[model samples]
Target: MAKIKDHPLRYDLVNELHARPFPALTVPCHAVYVAIKEAEHAVNRDRAADRAHLLALLDRNGSPHPQPDATHFSGAMGRHHLKWESHTEFVTYSAFGSGVSSRAFDPMEADVFPQDWLAGAPGTRLTSVLIRVEELPQDEAEMLAKLDDWFVPESLAMARVVDGAAVIAGDFRIDPAGHMRFAVFVKKGTGERRVGRIVQRLCEVETYRAMSMLGLMRARGLSGKLNTLDPQLSQLISGMNSPDHSPEEVLQTLLKISAELESLAVQFSFRFGATEAYEAIVTQRVSVMREVRVEGRQTFGEFMMRRYDPAMRTVKSVDARLRGMAERATRAAELLRTRVDVERSAQNQKLLESMDARADLQLRLQTTVEGLSVVAISYYAANLLAYIAYPVTEGLGLSKGMSMAIMVPVVILGVWAMVRRIRHKFH
Candidate 1:
């Protein structure tokens, strides 16, 4: 039997699903994660530069290069293992090393990514994180004490996740070193892969959270612009029914506002969409952790509700307002156009009436002119005929004056008949 042909990307697509697996990190390890994105047009940025930058870092550590067009790579970089992945709008690098810092959340521990190499990165750092993973202390109190010292009390969120497989905590605040920090306490006997997943999720939560907040900044600016445009649009609309402004003027201004609103929508659409996606990812990452509150402290879910969700809501509100304003402008313009059309119809009716009156007056004037033409022609013909008939009248023994008077009535009747005949033929 012949074997069936396979799809071209059969294995590639299958391999892609497992491409970026969680790093199987043993307990008492730390991970430094950073996500970089271009300052503008990140999705369309030069990906080759991203690859070259990764190669430079790999070179510094004497690590092997990834596949020619690899979107992700995991390799040994000196004492630490490095993982890099490229995404649509950003790229991330994760370095994992054995053992936690002797001094918790220490900046020096992140030296796995050399300062010089990072400085030469292709884009700005979206988020940098230092994750401290450790075996849970025998006494729960010790964990609680560490949490208090490491994170701010008011802002800290700590939770037991995955049915107590581990506990994760973070303040979600950038430290003086400009890196966010998260701590994971692995329960004894938990799988290494499970711990890795937890650590990865922690990094993701922060990265996505920071990325989503960019939408908030965009929203704030958009809101201010909308505020300025709103009154202008309202004023224009309010005058639409008033005589103060012509329909043409109102329509022109409305179109300007509508165009600007459309432009704003276009400009921020991608950013807002990306923010929403990032927000969803952050929520999902936190949810999958299945967090349980620790010491009555806030869970990741709760923290997001208080802080992150509000930012997302604000973005949504701004997007909605922009769309609403555009619609309002459209409605106003439509109304004004209708009014303009009605007014034009009225003016057209008046013009037609004037034309009708002028036609009637012209017809009357033409009739009067026809009558005068007949009379004048008859008088002139009568005199000329009488002169031509002088011989006949002389022979009849009639005077020239008597003959002219008699011919005048006859000539008038003949002229009227001739005029009627000509008018009939033309008509």
Candidate 2:
């Protein structure tokens, strides 16, 4: 029996699921993470540049290079192990090293990503995060005391996650050093692999949050543009029912307004869609962490609800407003088009009626001209017949006057009959 052939992409597709493996970290380890993206058109930017930059970092650390088309890489970068992944709109690098800093969430601990190397990045930094991971201390108040000094009290979100395996905390605010901070207090006896998963989820939550909020900025700008169009569209719609302007003019204006609205939809469609996806991801990442409340402290989910939720809602409201306006413009344009067609139809009906009246007048004039032609033809025919019969009548002792008089009626009748025959054939 012949062996069955394997599908070409079978192995590749399966491998993809396991490609970006979660890092295995023991307690008392810290990670420095940063996501970089272009200022504009980041999704479609030259991906080769991103790869080259990753290669540059690997080269500096004397690390083995990843495959030419690799989308993710994990290797040693001097004292720290680097994990790099390319994403749809950005690239992220996480440098994981053993032990936490004595200064709580200190910036100097992130020296794995050097200043000069970060400056040579292919894009701007979307977010830079400093994560401090440590085993839970014996006393809860000790952790609480450290948190107060590390993060802002008003914005801090702290939670016990993974069924009390760890307590995670972050302020959701950029520090003076321009990096966001998170502290993970791993419960003793949690597996090394589990610790990595917790940290990974934290990174995802922050990354997606930042990406999703981009939509809010776009939404604000869109509101300004829509504000300008709303009044113009309203005027055109109002003009549709007015006698001051013609239907054609109103329809033209409606068309322009509709086109403008459609253009805006097309321009922002991808960004809005991406925003929604990112928002869902952020929510999902936070939910899976299974956060439990820290006493007198807000959980990560609650923090998002109070602050981030409003921004996402604003983006959604703006998107909805844009759609509503587009729909309004479309309905108005359709109504105006119908009105223009109706008016043109009325004008065409008048034109057709005038043509029918002209046709009737022409037919009457032709009939009158035909009658006059018959009379003239018959007069000449009668004269010729009188001449022809004059000789015969004279020989029969009949006068020319009687001969001409008798033939006149017969000649006129014959001429009328002949004309009728010719007209029937032509018709």
Candidate 3:
């Protein structure tokens, strides 16, 4: 029997599925998460720099290094467990500690990464969050009081998820310390892995929400630009249908608008695309929570729908308008080109007709000149015949004037016939 060879990537690909497993978080643990991204070209940022930054953080705590070229790492950083993962457009650092902070939703708990280490990060912080995990209180009334005290009542979103295995709540507001906060209350019998997954999803929701809003901000910034470009495009397109404007002039204007629009599209392409992708991730993560109503409070999905969705829609609308404007500009240019081509074709036709008329006049003038030449030749031939026949006329008893008179008509007729034959043969 022949043995089969395995693909080089088979094992690596298989292991990839298990690569970024959720942390097995115990109850009463606290997590601090931060996502960092470049101001521009984040997806193409230097990976080596990110790795070096991660190494710097690990070195601060005297922890072991990740494998060479690792995309993710899980290790102990002092008393806290640190998890770092690299993504397409950003990187995230999360530190999970064994016990909750003494103060509920305390922003100081996020100090797992030393201030100096954070200051040395390669990119800007997109979002930072502090998550508090605790065992679910048996008294529902006490939990409600804690929630009301910890979070703003107006913006709070709370729900029970995973078939009531845990309850989650967040105000989705940045506190004075500049971090979003979330609290997870797990049931007594909940698995540690399930708790970890819930915390992970919460972090992901916040991260993706922040990322998606970047697109909204970009769209809002482009509003004034679009307002100006739209009218200019409309005016240029309208000029196409007006006889007052020349096609060449209109075409120039349209081309300028098209170039400008193309440049704008190129600038925003990545941002818009990344936003849409992040938005999808956000929605998916929320849906996976399988949220049930928190009665008198908004659910996570409902909050996003009410606030976030509208902004995303505006971005999408602006993107469509930009595309539409570009298309309109293209159509206007094509229309102008067609008009120019038609005008040129008409001019060429008139030129050909004028040439044909000139050719006809020249032909008629040449015919007139040929007629005069024949008469002149005939007159000379008659005179020559008269001279040559003078002696013969005297011998034949005929007068010279009479002989010449007889030859004149015959010479004229002969010259006319000869000229006609030449013209016919050439033709």
Candidate 4:
């Protein structure tokens, strides 16, 4: 066992590599040491012959020899103590029971390939490599040159060493006991930008995928309602669902469908709201009209009492004037009939009185004429008698004149009495 010193720069040297896990070649240090020891032993046994043969093979093949395929490498290392595995075509070489390994040399395809000869041994400590590099002599220039080539500085800021038979990134070195080890260091900022680019690409792809899904879902919903559509509208909707359409185009069609739906919703809402408002107004107006009708009836009754009654009095006055004119016309007609009747009655009474007066005057005139006629007849008869007497009396003695006087009075009396008797008979 080697006594190891604590190295402060060891943490910085391996920080980057330890930050992330990487697929690389790994081999146990014990297995690598054993393989080197076996090669040295083989060289000592037939040094002259083996050296000549190695030189000839190198001359013939070239500087770096090509590794065999995976199957060939696996078969060759199957009997070794170390077990080798490939990750993403990179080989991981380690001892079967060792907790340590060394990664060196990339394969042709950039894979990590494990050496077949190193197997079945324990791993060396990371401190062993630094101790071995410190033990190398710096006496001769050629020896110093060899050491310089075998061990490399870890980085600009860290002091570290790399020493092994295969100096992957440093100078070769050996300890007092002839054991070997290799450096394990990390590189910072390696492949970080590449990873970031890959992550961004993934995000963009996922976003577009989500948008496409949403458009398809909306298109499906629209298609379900197509049957109730108008003929002209259905034709337009059918065109949007065509098999050749892209998701973006389908989304545009869905936007147009939403526009039409919004317009219909607005129109229906306006009509319903307006109709409700109108009905309410009409109901209010009817109530107002009913109130007005009641008021009008009451007002008309009051008008009949205040204004119409006075107007009716004026009408009665005009009626009285008309009645007076009708009565005057009736009275005039009656007066004319009465005047005609009175004139006729008076004329009839006058005619009857004149006839009576004329008859009475005729009767009085007839009586006077009869009295004169009797006086004349009696006077003649008396004269004749007197003449006879005178003749005889002259012989005896009487006068004819005195006898005429006496007969006149008696004749008047007899005419008057005869006239009175005739008048009585007529009565």
Candidate 5:
């Protein structure tokens, strides 16, 4: 039997599931994460430049380069482990070091990413996060006390995740170091892989949340534009009901409104869509933790609902309003077109009526001219006949006056008969 052939993408497809594996993390470790995205037109940016930038960082560490077309990479950079992943519109870098700094949440923890190398990045930083993982204390009370010292009591959201194998706490606030902070406490005997997964989830929640808010910022900028357009559109739509404006004029205004709205929609379409996707991912990453309340503390899901959900809602509301305005403009344009067509038909009808009246007047004038021609011809024929009958009257001993009288009626009858015959032949 011939061997079955494999599909061309079979290997790639299967390997994708295992790609970007969770980092195997031990206790007393720290991680710093950064995401970078282009300031403008990020989705269509030169991706090769991003890859080159990644290569530059790897070269600085004397590390092996990732494959030419690779989207993710993992390597050792001195005392830290570097992991990089490229996304549709951005890129992320994370570095894990084996031990925490002497000062908790120290500003220097971010030094895993060299300052000079970061300055050379092709894009701006979207967000940066610092995460710390430590072994649980012998007593649970000590861990709770540490959480209080590290995070704000009012804003802290601590939970027992991974079936209580670990506890996670974060205030979701930026520290003086300009980075969000997260802390993980692992239960004794908990595997390193599980702890790593929890830390990764924390990084993702922060990263995706920041990314999602970009959409909100874009929406807020567009909101001012929408405010200007809304009143203009409403004014134009109201003009449609006015009898003073011509259909053509109203149509012109409607078309202009439609065009401007469409242009705005095109500009912000991708940002809004990307925001929605990132929001869902943020929510998913938070929910996947299966977080349960730890000592009745707030959870990540609740914090997002309170702080993040409102921003997402604003973007959605603005997006919907834009669509509604476009639809209204379209409907108004159609109505104006119909009105213009009806007015044109009425004008054509008036023109046709005037033409009919002109034709009737022309027919009457022609009949009067024909009657005059008949009278003039008979008079000339009578003279000619009277002259010819003169010689005959003398031979018959008749007077010229008598002869003329007799010829007058005979000539008139002859001319009238001749005119009738000619008119009948032509008809």
Candidate 6:
């Protein structure tokens, strides 16, 4: 059993409560802890102020009602309803809630509680109940049962029993929400067993909450990364059709994708804490090439200075010119590579147009040749026909040569008209 110091009750109530620890009960809402000391005489005049501060905390958090008496302050705080029970020299505050949880004990509020009421000495007692039940032995159940009976249900009390051992227990209700409301009792016995249990429970609950928060943060980061990658992929696909795009552009797009993948991989590694997974991703092969863009003005300025600068009168700037030319040549090479397919397509279109024009010209030439042949054939035929008719006509008084000559011109004109009609029909 730990020793409980007997200081003046007016200056030591908080410390006394600290010496006795309680279980860390999980509450659905928040809860509050208040320690009261018995005040005596003019020495502990600040006890009234202490009570006021505790009530203020409750009121600030939306207490249902206020305490009517100066010695007894009451209000609602967190998950619990509270009342301060004060005597001439001893004071105690009772907290009643559906459940009691660690969140109810705000460290900032505890710091603000009046220390002068305890006579300028800070309370050393563990005022917050953070004990757990799992650390106790089964044989101690009888002792715990005895301590349980001491719980006032409506008041917080502790009485020392015989044999330098005292039992402390609390009646706590587990609500449907898994919140626990405890009427705590502490038997003044070995402090080691009780305090050990309380500390363990508090740590476990805190760890669980922290892990949940981390999980949510990691999920949000992953979602953002995926959204960024989606648009980048679309842009890369569209840029593929541009005639001026280079292999470096393609490589740069791929590199950007790889960079995003690496970022995701890094986040995954941190979330999972898997070094092997990170290493595997890094080992995967990737190729990257990017064009180093030089502004046009800067490039031209450098070329002019190299070709015309008078820094060296005798020396020729052939080397500088070669360097400048090399840079231009490199850019030209990249441009050529990127636009090769487009240029080839344009050349093929021109060739097809030339072929169509040649074919049309050939068709016109063939039609003219056919017309000429028709004219010649018609003239010859007309002449032959006229000759044959000449002998017959001479007996009827017509000349053979005159008929042939006249028919020749008529035959030629008739062939020309027929050819024109044929060409018009086809065209």
| lDDT of each candidate versus the true structure | 0.91, 0.90, 0.90, 0.34, 0.87, 0.42
Off by over 4 Å in 6: 1-349, 376-392, 396-402, 424-427
Candidate 2, residues 151-228, lDDT tens digits: the string is 899999999999999999999899888899999999999999899999999999999999999999999999999999
RMSD of each: 3.1, 1.9, 3.0, 59.2, 4.3, 28.6
Ranking by TM-score: 2, 3, 1, 5, 6, 4
TM-score of each: 0.89, 0.95, 0.90, 0.21, 0.85, 0.26
Prediction 2 TM-score vs. true: 0.95
- On lDDT, the stronger of 4 and 6 is 6
What's the lDDT for residue 47 in model 5?
Answer: 76
TM-score of 1: 0.89
Candidate 5 local lDDT, 275-356, one digit each (tens): 8999999999988999888888888888889989999999999999888888888888888888888889999899889888
Residue range with the least summed lDDT across 10 consecutive positions in model 3: 38-47
What's the count of clashing pairs in each model shown? 0, 0, 0, 16, 0, 23
lDDT by residue (212-246, candidate 1, tens digit) is 88999989999999999999999898777788777
Indicate the TM-score of model 4.
Answer: 0.21
Best by TM-score: 2
Error of 4 at 416 (Å): 1.9
How would you encode candidate 3's per-residue C-alpha lDDT over 120-139 as one tens digit per residue?
Answer: 88889999999999999998
Give per-residue lDDT, candidate 5, residue 336.
Answer: 82
Q: What's the distance in Å from true for residue 289, model 1?
A: 1.0
Where model 3 places Cα greater than 4 Å from the true spot, the runs are 373-427
